[model samples]
Target chain A: MIEGAVWRKWVFFYIPLAAFVFLLLFPFYWMIITAVRPDAELYRPWNAPNYAPFWTANPTLEHIRYLLEETLFSTWMLNTMIIALVSTLISLVCGVFAGYALARLNFPFAGGLGTGIFVTYLVPQTLLFIPLSDIVRNFRLGDTPWALILTYPTFLIPFCTWLMMGYFKAIPKELEECARIDGASRFKAMLYIILPIAVPGILSAGIFAFTLSWNEFIYALVFLSSPEQKTVPVGVTSELIRGDVFFWGPLMAGALLGSIPVALVYSFFVEHYVAGLTGSVKG
Target chain B: MAQVVIRNLNKKFDEVHAVKDVNLDIRDKEFMVFVGPSGCGKTTTLRMIAGLESVTSGQILIGERVVNDLPPMDRDIAMVFQNYALYPHMSVYDNMAFGLKMRKFDREEIRRRVHEAADILGIRDYLHRKPRQLSGGQRQRVALGRAIVRHPQVFLFDEPLSNLDAKLRVQMRVELKKLHERLGTTAVYVTHDQVEAMTLGDRVVVMRDGVVQQVGEPLELYNRPANLFVAGFLGSPAMNFSRVRVAAANGGLRIENEGLRLAVPPPLAGRVGRYVGRELTFGIRPEDLRIATEADPRDLSFEAVVEVVERLGSETLLDLSVGADTMVAAVEPDAPARVRGRLRLAVNPERMHFFDPATETAV
Candidate 1:
């Protein structure tokens, strides 16, 4: 009787996890099926006799070839890489110093400053876009990748700084003090001691910053006016919807290709990424 | 080896005075331990000397140079924290060599010093392991090795062994004393443990409420505490104090308590003469009280019911009540005593201490 009850408990525990796995993977499976199906089978009725099987023989690579060959997909990918890399780099440099200062330094209004940084992050980017557009126009950087790199840090820095603050706080204060007494200057101690120890957190923050820049859409759509300077989100959107007509095949193909870089980057830093995200979410 | 001189040092945090107008001189190559209860500013004092904490006033001198304004990097000192504070990411070798590298020493010199320190700390074999990979004792040794490699003029240990188990703490206490003797470096260690201070320090500074109560050799502090605080703080089973009054009695000063009275020592009779009718705090160490049998004349005696008798293998501790006041007495483990028994105990009159009732100062 005890064995039967234990087996029932195990079954109850695994059922939801199994169901969630199937739900998560089903969409990806459908997307792949849609991407490879012949054009005639794209929208067949559910009750039709010609509905494709799981292992259909009519699979085609036409959409993938079309996305790669006819459009400026490669250029958009390159532009996205440049903007994300530059933004992530800038955010890390400014955010890490600000985070360390907020965590360790004592000043008249240090706590207020930390709270202010977090408040800045809470101000949605949608609300700042109008004022930011005028600033970008004034700087004469409207149609360049530099515009995105410069604008992204506004959102990225605050959140990154907040995340880094939590990471720094988790570290023992004694470690830094020991380093200081061991002939390390404040900067040297942070670099040699604090920074090395905070690598996982920093990497996690960097991955978040990179992914944010790569996947960002609203700002990129409103900011970039030229095709050559557009990021993946804006470029894909503009190309997929010319006038009122939709191009589902190439759109899905572009999206699949566009998301690959971010997916690869996340996988590379999955450990730090999880840690960093959890730290930020809790904050 | 260098002497540390802290003159009129004061540290204030906003409105609270963390350390107030402290003045102390630690001799060259002395193993000085600052011991106190929590929030007694022992750590604050040590940090101020290490240049990790800034002084609000006065000066600190290492050797002959005033180092009040110097940064920690320029002060030339090393500290071992209570938690060991080993860099979790670095190997033991790198942790030990870090200070040398930071000072821009030659790579060969750094390697040589690290290996030498590691050898002395018995961590030569664990040099490749990170801090988390080593046991608590090994990590503690690595922390000491890190300080040793720096070869600083002074070493500051901020409760370095407080995290160790009881047996390990005793072992490390002996090792630390031997290490100090071998290196002969000026070291300022901070701890709340009186046993650690007594066993390790050449001189112990007993502190309370951000002030130094007494500073003397371990035995001197134990035998002759400067104040009630020092006397109470130094002993393990702390000295018991009871309200007593001095009375004029036939050619000697009579110390009278609620249920006991004894003649004052000859040396203290004249000093305590002025307080003949005044109430004072009488202190007696637990170890000084013993079972009184027919073989000895009881100078000061008390008959009390044993409330609790703890047999600790080597020593037996008895908690007894006399006239509503409870006191603990330590006797031989094999002594024939049991709970609820009426026992006769003798307090040695010469070992008794008297303090001013209001001022709490030793009379």
Candidate 2:
């Protein structure tokens, strides 16, 4: 009886937790189910049972095979990875230095500069897409990943810099002073002391920049005209829609595959991601 | 080890002079302390000597070299800050080895010095543990160890013990004195605590309002303060002061106040004669005022109403008021005294201090 009460206590606490867990897992579960279901079962009414019993039914790999063979899904995935990785690297390099400067150095108009950079982040990408599209068209870089790479950094750099600046500011100035007094040059101090301590924050900001580049749809949709040059979001949406009819199986399959890598990256750096978000918001 | 000399050191923040015309000479292998209240520029003066703050005008010399234009690292001074300033990310070993590594010392040499400092600080076992895992006292030891490993020409302490609890502060104070004795390195310490100044320093310099008030051996400053500020700032329970007028009586000097009058010692008669009939302030320490007994004459006595009696174990502090003036008297804990009762207290004439009111200068 006593053991049951103790078990009940745990169950009481975990019930809502389990419900939230189920709530989060439900959409992914449904997507996997819909992707594997035959076309006959997929069109059934809402009240009908659309899922096959896992033990009795034989699962098929047709959707995965079709996604690979019928469309430029692999090419789109490769292009997205390259664009995201390059953009993240660029943002990290620019953000770290700008963050360090905003956090530590005092220059003429430094406060104004910090506020100006943060305000640039506040301007929505939706508002600037028209003007940026004109610039990309003027440069004749349309239908190329180079356009996305160049345009994405404009959004990534400001927000990433703002995140890293807040993170760097939380570090004690005395630590750097101690390094300086210990015979380190200013550059060496930043490399040895500040950078090591700021790793988590930097990683968090990098993940954010990578995810933003990967998930961006509107700009990718409007800018890239060639099917082969399209990123994951644009390629999936444009190729999956034929004419008022959706190819639910392969589309959902590609979407699920496309989001997995990013989800895994986020899960790996969840602690730092949360810290970065709160840190940037607080600042 | 090297002597640190500050000549006409002045620092200005806008129109406010934080440290003004402050000239200080700290000898090699000597432990000197700067003692003052807040905003008195003791810490500012120390920072200027460390090259952490710029001297608006004047020169700082470590040994024979002018360090006014030098950075802190080139100045060869290690400072133990009040907050310990240990690297939160680094373990104790790394914190101590950081300075040596930055100087491009050999790896083996760095390891030897870090271990030696850790052993001296009794933090060897905890070298791999981060700072947050250590207690306050342990962290303080790590800070001291970091400075000790550098073996710099001068060690500067900016009220290093101020952050510790009272009990740990006393313990650290004794350990610091022992460390100073063992090393015999030139050290400049800053503190607002007079007791810390008296106990730790070979020579104490008291400052006020960005000016050097008095500089001398602790006992010299205690026994013979330079002025009213020094007298009031040095002692606990503080010295009592009352305005009085000096008048000549039978070839001697009589110090008269509203409640009482007493004869000045003959040696001070000449000094008092110049200020005769002029209003002056008389100062006396709490310990110097004793209860009148058969051993002391009644002529130097005054009546005081005892407002409160604090019965500390070894000694008693009596709070007494005479007319509009209040004074504290320290006596044997067993002394017979009751609150709300009148007591006769005798002032030792030879121990009394007289100051010129207008200049606040000793007379």
Candidate 3:
């Protein structure tokens, strides 16, 4: 954006930007190249004559075909989609109401309650999973999607609540008050006026919750032991590697396919997601 | 249209008392304004009447019903907020029609009222557009349109025009008067701007620190303010104050201070004679001070050194040092005055105000 000569633009803007883009995209590029490259090149020694790690001459769909046919990739995809979606929905519903109450309602200990909710989010899945695993077993939800679906919200709700609390706070209180004076009850006012204005905020919360649950790992790893019940992050890593012999091509294929849905979700709600982060509520 | 009455209103927000024992009977079709500085509880009082804020312990009656426990929707009122608060998601038409829609007033009736309000506010062309697309003034009109479309029994404006620029504010002020005249709905407006309160309200309530200082017509409050705060709060350049002692000198009562001494007018001389030797606060408006001319009486004039001369086109304001106190005098624009100049300024004897120093109340 700096207006100047070519070298100034290069020094301040373009070169740094190009370097950043290259660095960020390198992993994805490597993933695609490894997934498509022939297994001979993938497993070839580095000292071989035609060893070109970054480039491949004969690209094939064998890894993708093997991932779909030989492994439970499709079932994992379905499991992840359902678990992520259901948890995101539960988190969003709880988050929106909890956020609105924390932001707008004048109740005793509301401030302390909001802080308490945030502190729960910070308990770290690494440590909390020990206690949660006990809780998961007590109900015997292991090896089923129910284990992940019910547990994902334990973390996702807090995250969505905090994000949505800040977002709801940024909205002007007068919108709801004006709606009330305009002859709508408090609930109606929220539905007709405040919530409509908070659409961007809610979407951003939902998108974040969706993305967080989609990319989640620990809970998916601990629970749901069945091959058909496993989520993508758990299924891809567990099934692809066998006793130190890595299935690099199919693993990369699993990663690439697993990330596509998240990418699509982001692209679809990109505008709202950005607006929600920047806190642009036009009066 | 129904009158709104607030009786024995008191509100305590935990440790802070936001509104004190307040009483006002806003008449049917009356435009009542509550004007004060921030934290003076004018908006709190308005919100209490709007049923947005609960009364800590009091009664608010909109028409004949005591609405202390009624919800805002049940209060049958409309309010215009300072930020406009137009639903950003809805089109202008939908924004205006939302109340009607919530009431289950069918499609055609909602359309009729929305269009009628849009026509009145001159916002028909932007009916399909969103709030963010409109200018500030247009958005203000849309907010007004939204309120008018509801046709509520009462209208509450919580500093609605404060967000507007100066020119647009003046324009809107006039339009609000015209709108009120057209609708004749009871209104309760709150603002920190004294000029707005003076121009717009049929009756203005001046408050300070959660207490109602005075309530009267705008000119009544301007001419005969109840206390020191009201006299100082209403005027443009503010009234000047000087601590002076009243004493019997020669034959009659005279007001004497470090910088000036002037005889009391005969009408107030008997009243002034009672507080002979005690010190009290003296107040005189800047506009009542003039450049002393040849015909000016000697005892009613004083000489001072002018510090700064500000010619504001219509009037000239001189910041002057009198004894140990700084005083501002608003004189005629054509007056020959300069900084560092020794100038004689005359005071209108009839316009002088006196208040007890301890009570700070007019004597």
Candidate 2 lDDT at B174 equals 98
What are the RMSD figures for all models against the true structure?
2.6, 3.7, 1.7
lDDT of 2 by residue, A1-283 (tens): 2256767856776676789999999888877876786666666665666544322154566887898899999999999999899988998999999999998997778889999998988888899899999999999999988889888988899988898888888887767777777888889999998888788899988998999999999889888989999988889889998888898888888888999889999898999777665642110
TM-score of each: 0.96, 0.91, 0.97
Q: Against the true structure, whose TM-score is highest?
A: 3
Tens digits of lDDT, candidate 3, B79-116 = 99999999888899998998788778989999999999
Winner on DockQ between 1 and 2 is 1
Q: Give the winner by TM-score: 2 or 3.
A: 3
On a 0 to 1 TM-score scale, where does candidate 2 land against the true structure? 0.91
iRMSD, all candidates: 5.2, 4.8, 1.1
Best by DockQ: 3
**Segments of candidate 1 deviating more than 4 angstroms:** A1-11, A45-47, A52-57, A275-283, B295-299
Q: Candidate 3 — which residues are off by over 4 angstroms?
A: A2-5
Clash tally for model 3:
0
TM-score computed on alpha carbons, candidate 3:
0.97
